[model samples]
Target: MSGSDIAGLIAAGVFAVLVALLAVPIVKLGRVFDELRSSIRTLSDGATPLMDEVTSTVSTTHEQLKRVDGIAANVSDATANVSALSSLVAATIGSPLVKVASFTYGVRTAWSQREDSSRPSGRRSR
Candidate 1:
C-alpha cells in the first residue's frame, strides 16, 4: 500500500476511536434524562391524590366556618334580647323604688322637725 493510503486509514481509525470515546458520556446523559422523567411522573402521580384530599379538607373547613357564623349570629341575638329585658326590668322596678325611698325620707324629716320645735331649749329666746 502507498504511504497516503496508510495515513488516511490511520486518520479514519483515530476519528472512530474519538467518536466511541465521546458516545459513552452521551449515552449516560440520556439515561440520566430518562430517570429524571420517571421521577417527575411519579411525583405527579402522588400529588393528584394529595390535591384531592386538600380540596376535601378545604370544603369541610368552609362548611364548619359557616356553622360557626350561624352560631355567632344566634349568640348575638340572645345577648341583645337579654339587654332589652334587663332595661325593661330596670324601668319597671327602679322608678317605683326611687319614689318610695324619697317619700320615706320626707316623712322622717317632717317628724323630726316637729319634735325638735316642741321640746324647749335651756337658753332663753332673745
Candidate 2:
C-alpha cells in the first residue's frame, strides 16, 4: 500500500476510538436529563394538589374570620344593651334609695340633738 493509504487507515482508527470514548458520557448525560424530566413531572403533580389544599384552607379561614367578626359584633351589641339596662335599673332604684337614706340621716341627727340638749352637762340622763 501507499504511505497516504496507511496514514488514512490510521486516522480512521483513531477517529473511531475517539467517538467510542465520547459516546459513554453522552449516553449518561441523556439518562440524567431523562431522570430530571421525570422528577420535574413528579414535583409538578405533587404541587398541584398542595396548592389546591392551600386554597381550600384559605377559603375556610376566611369563612371562620367572618363568623368571628359577626360574633364580635353580637358581643358589642350585647354590651351596649347591658349598659343601657344597668342605667335604667340605676334610675329606677337609686332615686328611692337616696331619698330613704337622706331621711334616715336627718331623723338620726334630730333625735341625737334633742337627747343631748335634754341632758345636763357632766351628768347621765339615765
Candidate 3:
C-alpha cells in the first residue's frame, strides 16, 4: 500500500479504539445512574414509615403532656385547699386554747398578789 493509504488506515484504527474506550465509560455511567435511581426510591420508601412513626410519637407525647399538665393543676388546687383548711382548723382550735391560757395566767397572778399582802414582811409563817 502507499504511505498515505497506510496512514489513513492507522488513523481509522485509532478512532475506533477511542470510540471503544469512550463506550466503556458511557456504559458505567448508565449503571451509576440506575443505582442512583434505585437508592433514591429506597430512601423515599423508608422515609414514609419513619415519618409515620415520628408523627405518632409526637401525638402521644402531646397527649401525655396534657395529662401531666392537668394533674399538676389539680395538685396545685388541692394544695391551696389544704393550706386554707389547715389555717381554718388552727384558728378554730387555737382561739379557745389561747383564751384558757390567758384566764389561768390572770388567776395565778391575782392569787399571788393576795398572798403577798396577807404575809407580814419580817415574820416567818408557821
Predicted candidate 1 versus true structure: per-residue lDDT over 25-61, tens digit per residue: 9999999999999999999999999999999999999
- What's the residue-level lDDT of 17 in candidate 1? 100
Cα lDDT tens digits for candidate 2, 1-126 = 999999999999999999999999999999999999999999999999999999999999999999999999999999999999999999999999899999999999999999998888895768
User: 93 in model 3: Cα distance from truth in Å?
Assistant: 2.4
Off by over 4 Å in 3: 1-9, 98-126
| TM-score of every prediction relative to native | 0.69, 0.66, 0.64
**Candidate 2 displacement at residue 18 in angstroms:** 1.8
Q: Clashes in each model (backbone N, CA, C under 3 Å)? A: 0, 0, 0
Candidate 1 stretches greater than 4 Å from native:
1-7, 101-126
Can you give the lDDT of residue 25 in candidate 1? 100
Question: lDDT tens digits, residues 9-116, model 3?
Answer: 999999999999999999999999999999999999999999999999999999999999999999999999999999999899889989999999999999999999
Output the number of the TM-score-best candidate. 1
Global CA lDDT computed for model 2: 0.98
lDDT of 2 at 97: 89
Cα deviation of 86, candidate 1, in Å: 1.6
Q: Which rank order by TM-score, best down to worst?
A: 1, 2, 3
